[model samples]
Each structure stands twice: as C-alpha cells, then as structure tokens.
Target: MRSLRQTTARWLAAAFLAGAALAVQAADPAPIELAAGVYMVPGTGGEPDPANLGRTGNAGFIVGPRGVLAIDTGTSYRHGQALLAAIRGVTDQPVRLAIVTHTRQEFLFGAAAFREQKIPVAMHQAAADLMATRCDTCLKTLRSLLGEDAMQGSAMFTPDIVFTDPLALDAAALIGRPIQLLHYGHSSGPGDIAVYDPRTRTLFAGGLLEARRIPDVGDSDLPRWREALRNLQALPVEVIVPGHGPAGDKRLITQVERYLDQLTARARALVNAGAPLSEVADATAMPEFATWDQYETTHRRNAAIVYLRYEREQLVK
Candidate 1:
C-alpha cells in the first residue's frame, strides 16, 4: 500500500483545480451554538461566486468551562481572526486548542492565525507531513485562485501536534465537558479526523460526511470510505457538523454513504467492463446529484478519479 502521505498529496492535484477561479473579500460568518456550548460557523455552500467567493466549509468550537477547542479554521488568516473575534464576543474563556480536520487549502490555511497565539494545533500525522511538504505549493495555488489581496494574511502551516489515534480532552474536569478526537482512518483522505462530544451527542465529522455538496473523492478508497461511514453511523451522535455545508442529523451519514456507494459501484463496474478512463464520467451518471452545487464542475472529475483509484487497487492485489 502507498504511504498515507502519498495518498493525500494527490488530493488537490487530482481534481479540485479544474474548477473556475475567483476571489473576493469575504468574512467568516457568525457562529451558531448548536448545543449548550458547541458553536458552529456555517459557510456559504454555494460555489465560488461573487457572493461567497468560494468559502464553502464549516468551522466550529467546543467551549468547556475552562477552555475552548476549535475545529477546522476558515480559508484565510482574516477568516481565522474573525472567527476568534466571534468566539470572544460570546465566551470569556480562552481558545486553547485547534484541530486540523483535513488537508484542503480551505481547512489548513487559516491555522496560521491560531499558531500566532502559540495555540497548539493537532492533526493526524499523515496530514501534517503532507501539509509540511506541500504547504508552499498549496499557498501559491490559493493565491492564484483567491487573488493575493484576499489571501494576503493567509499562510500554509503544519499543525504542531500529530496523533495516530483519537485523543480526549478532559475539559469536563476543569470546565464541564470532554471532547474526543477520532482518527476515522481514510474517508475523504488518508488524514481525515473527526471531533465528538459525548455530552451533546454532537460530531464534527469533517469531510467524512457532507450535506448538499457532494464530498470530494480525489484521495479516497471507496470501500474504506464507505466502511468509515458505517463506523460513524454507529456512533451515538445526534447532530453532525459536516466539513462543508450546514450542520445536520445522522441522516447526513446515510446520504453521503449512499452517494459514495452508488458512485463507487458504478465506477467499478465500468472499470471492470474495460471502459476508457475519460468515459468514466458519462458511465457513472448521477442525476440524483444534479441539483447539488458544483455538480457540473466537479462530478465528472470525481468519477474519473474514483475509477482510476479502483483500477490502481486492482493492480496492487
């Protein structure tokens, strides 16, 4: 098997770059406390239009009486600063820890802001390694897409802490709650991890489960991803904060799993029948996902990548 870092490094290079590029001055949206102290800042799930400027993803925080833990920073330094400002307006506790949820430019870039505070950021070791190697390249790519001014204060950074398994923050001892950092093991990428709060039955699933927007498949093992969803479904989670789009119920798990299953099944069938790689797009036609944002721009590439990955796995076996 390829190293996890190698699997993740291909994520953006595989497909995300095919979409249109645009930039604008966008602020991080306000934070909504979904549970007693769990706050979420919902992103504009819409495409990179003038209105949203492609800021599509969710960032949130868990406030314990003693300290706060944030999950996934926004797309820029400005966004992270705005998020911190929002957190300050609501709570007096200091934001102590930050979690890097994925390797996407949107997910990891804003972490620089947290680093400035000497706040330690944590992520899967695979992800941190990949970020360290490609941080500069990803920054340049973001600069090109969002324009230098929009990305002015933004920077690429590696998380200070890395874990191979889940870690628990015993904030309840000091404050009143405890949070679990779960290393779900290769859903959207080799480095994906999630945050869960037992008290609220809330799970910050990261990109492992998505709502309206179809999850990206560039760095995926369809079978493993599907298995990961089943594992997440088994959790005692009431509300889920998807990596992108809005916060949702356990149904998001089913929605994303079904979509992934259908796409993988169709792609594998076509590959078995000896279909051309380019034809994987038409072969795995998904009218059910027609209404989803970025469908036209991203789906075709998703089909091709999934098909190519299956072909690769078969060769390995």
Candidate 2:
C-alpha cells in the first residue's frame, strides 16, 4: 500500500488530469433556482483545467428576506466573483454569511473572494484545521495546473466562523427558511458537513456526497461514511446539490451509499482472498459503475485504499 502522502499526491495529480484531453468547454455559471429562494450554480464536472477555470464544484445560495447565505465560494477568486455576481443578479440582499462546506480545493480558496467582500466565512473546525495544514500545497498545485492567470488573486484565508457541533441558523430571521449545518464525525473527510433546508427539503451535501462522479476515498473512513449516509437518509431531503455533478433528488444519496458499499465489499473480498495490494485495483473493477466520471482514476484508487484499510483492520483484530 502507498503511504498516505504518496496516495494523496497521486490522487491530486489524477484528479487534475482526469479529462484533460477533452475539448475545452464553458458552461454558464448562472444560478439555477431549485425552489422559491434556493439556487444552485452547477459545476462543469471533470478535472480542473483552464477550460473549466477550476470551477468543477457546485456552489449555491439560500436567499431570505433578511439576507443571503452562500453555500460555497468556488475554486478560485474569479470563480467566487462569478458566484457573488450570480447572487447579486438575483437579489440585492446582503450576503450575511458564506460557508466553506469542506476542505476540498474546489470548494475552498474562493473564500478569499468572499472575505474581500467582507462577507464572513464559516467552516467546521475540523475542515478548517485540515485546510490549514494542506491547502497551501493545494493552492500551489492549482497554480501549477490551472496557470497563474486563472488562479490570479486566489489565496486562502481563515474562516470567520468555526463550529464543532451541529448548528441551527435562525429560520425566523431567515424568514421561515430554516437551515441546519450538520457534521458527522470524520466521514468523507475530517469535517464533512451538509447544509439542510427543511422548508424546501434541499440538501447542499458537500464532500459528504457526490452524484454520478466516484466519491474520492483518499481521506475517507468507510464505516463512518456509511453511518453518516444513513443519518442523512433519515432526513426529509427532496433535492441534493452534491459536491460534484448536477442536482438530483433523494436517490443521489442512495446512489452514493450503494457505491461505497459495493466498493468496500469488493475490496474486502480481495483482502480476505489474500490478493496482493498491487493487483487489488485491477481485480476489483466494477463494470456497473464504469460510466461514472473518474471511474478510471478515483474508483481504482478507492479499491486499493479500501483493501489496505480492511487489511489493516484484520491485522489489529
């Protein structure tokens, strides 16, 4: 098994280079309203490149009579600026807060744009710590891959609000639109969190979930991630704005859960059969998910990761 550092580096490289050969395409970054006051700016899914301008992650906003709450900032300062413009185009309400949902590069770095606007940024304490330790390196990688011009003025900043527990925002102040920030300990990442809007039954499931795209397991704990998905399933979610891919209904949650389960089962079987770690990736291929984005890169890595994890579990037992 690869060391965590080496695995992370490999994952980062693959993640950035996954769909590099495809023709560069641009999509409108305009916000699409999901409900009365909820809107999502869909990402151009795939690896970050000059074509996508690193805007490969979904960002959203919940507008209320009092103010607006932005879901994520985006990948770079320019991306964040585009998001802020999208929000402005819809409403003149002051942006009360901006939430950095997780530690992923696609959802971070853009916080600098929000901070420049004087909008306070919020993050789970764990996510903030993870960012503190690794985002500088991530930023450097982005600059190298996306170019300095694309990443111009993009930088990291400390979150203005950090919470370690589940937090409930003032729905009444938000004009009857209740928003809940939920954290499931160390699931998808150290501090993966989801934003739940009860009124619209919309969930801005950050790093905790993905639709279509393979969930990156580099920093994941499978059992805990499964548990977290179970808890989310209990919610009355009607729509999900995933960390990647287009918004979908409750089924997105189930799809992610199913993928994780299958990935774990296949990896566990390989480990139980005493298969060499080097062969686990090729041996554990799932043709069922072959069409999903990053299946070629992320899924193969996920299989090896789960194999190593289960192998370690057996040793300690």
Candidate 3:
C-alpha cells in the first residue's frame, strides 16, 4: 500500500507540472477584439497575470467619421503600440482623440505613442497635476512591478486637455455617442473619472470599481473611495470597463463597494481592539475576493494604509 501511494503521488505531481507548463505555453499576448470597434488589450506586467492571463488594464476604441477615440493606454510602450495597431485593424482612420481614465502609468504611458499622430489626450485637471508631480514615483513603482522591459517601454504623458468636472466631448468622426467625463471624488488616486459613452451606456470606471481582484489602496483614502463608489452608483450604466479586470456589468461597481466596506470595517475593528498593523495584516483575509491573482500584493498593502489612517484617528481621539 505504501509503494502504491508513493507512485500515485509522483504521477499526480508530474501531471500537475505538465498541465501548468501547457498553460504557460498556450498563453498569448496582445489584445482581442471583443466587439466591432472595441478591443481588450491584456497587460504584460511582471505581477501575477490577471485571471484573464493579462495585466490589470484595458483600452477601447470607437470609430466614427470624425476620427477614432481611444480610451486608456496600456502599461508599456509595446502595449500602446499594439493597442494602436489593434485600433488600425478595426479602422484605418487616424486616432483622433485619446482620453485617460486615471493617472496610473499602466493606463496612461501609452499616450506617448499617439502624440506624434496629433491625437489630443484628455484627462481631469487633478490627474494632469498629479502626473506632473508624481510621474517619477508612478514610473518607479511600475518598473518594480513590471520589471525593466515594461519600464523601458513606459513614458510619462500628461493630458493635453483638462476638465475640472464633467465634460462632454463630441468626436464627429467616431461611431459612438459623445463621451462624458464625470468626475467622481478622489478614490483610486487624485483623479477618478467615469468615462461614459451614451450610445453603449458603457462606463469605463478606472479603479473606482474593480471586479474580482483586490483594490489597490496604496494612495487611496478609504472615506473618499467609499464616497466615490457611492457617487458612481447613480449612473445608468450598462457595461463597466474596470481598470484591472475583465469587463462586466453594473454589479462590478457594487461588488467593489462591498469589498471596500468590509476592508474598512475590518480595519476599524482591528484598530479598536488595539491590534498592531502586522497582526491586522495576518488577520484580515478578504474571503469574498476569490479571484484575486496575488492575494498578498493588495491585501497587505491595503491593510497597511488602513492601519496608518487608523493610528492617526486614534491619536486624534
């Protein structure tokens, strides 16, 4: 019986290894066309790939007579170049307008590719300012997360057009409806905009509503993030383009709100009980978040941020 058990275990281990190797071998990079004008560009970040086998970012295109409007660039220059090529594949029309959902490099660095083409990049004023001041830090962190290849490919590109609040852009050439930039409070970063396409009723919510994956709260204010998500709930959205995961429906935003609620509650409970940051990190497990790629990456970092705020609150009282 012992001999049989050892043989079976070895076979099982070999089978698992073979399956993993096959999965890696089959994985392909670049974007996939989800619809006529829309494409899903996967990321090549060094971090554990998203469940979709891509990095945590997406780009979109809407072709019209005036020109093509592309939404959010990917992490590296290669990603951006690929995105532009994918857009051209959809329509020979030059990219007329490029708008960003946030200030994160994963979503903005690709804008550099569109510059010489004279495509105007649009973003919120706060994001433009934050990009100017923190571009180096963002670049450094992305380099750390994605390695040298991704770092060399990424370049800082700020928005040429800045909107203080909601602004409707009419791309006369694009096939989609006018794009609306609705400013939600500072949740993910200094600038979080809900990119709404009236025709599709699709809302490209940057990091305000991540689905399945853990929220990146490195520079987040829990209170503000909560408020921002709440504000997002009011929009009549049909589809949601998340910053980090597969595109889904309105439930994406709701699910994220629930996670934030739980994360905030857990942080409060730990602080109330006089637990140390390290202990809280060990204790807080986002049981509801089953699809997170690297559980430790976001969980520990989020806990640390919550702990910092918790300690500040305690000191105030």
Instruction: Give the TM-scores of the predictions, in the order they appear.
Output: 0.86, 0.90, 0.80
lDDT of 3 by residue, 73-150 (tens): 766565667678877766786787787878776677777777756778887788888889978886777666656775
Q: Write model 1 residue lDDT over 1-317, tens digit each, in one string.
A: 85533432332222122112211234556677667798777776655433564466778898987888888877777667777887887899888888888887777777778888887788888888777887788778767777777677887665777777654443344345677777667767878888898887888988687777878888776777888888888898767888876666788898888788888889899989999887778778899988876687678888888888889989899
lDDT of each: 0.74, 0.83, 0.66
Candidate 3 error regions (>4 Å): 1-39, 44-55, 140-153, 168-176
Each prediction's total of clashing residue pairs, residues at least 3 apart in sequence or on different chains, is: 1, 0, 9
As a TM-score, model 2 comes out at: 0.90
User: Which pairs clash (backbone N, Cα, C closer than 3 Å) in model 2?
Assistant: none
Residue range 57-163, candidate 2, lDDT tens digits: 88889998888999999899888888899999999998988888889999998788899999988888898999999999999999999999989999978888887
What's the alpha carbon RMSD for model 3? 9.9
Residue 307 lDDT in candidate 1: 85
Instruction: Say which prediction, candidate 2 or candidate 3, comes out ahead on lDDT.
Output: 2
Ranking by lDDT: 2, 1, 3
Clash count, candidate 1: 1
- Candidate that would win on lDDT: 2
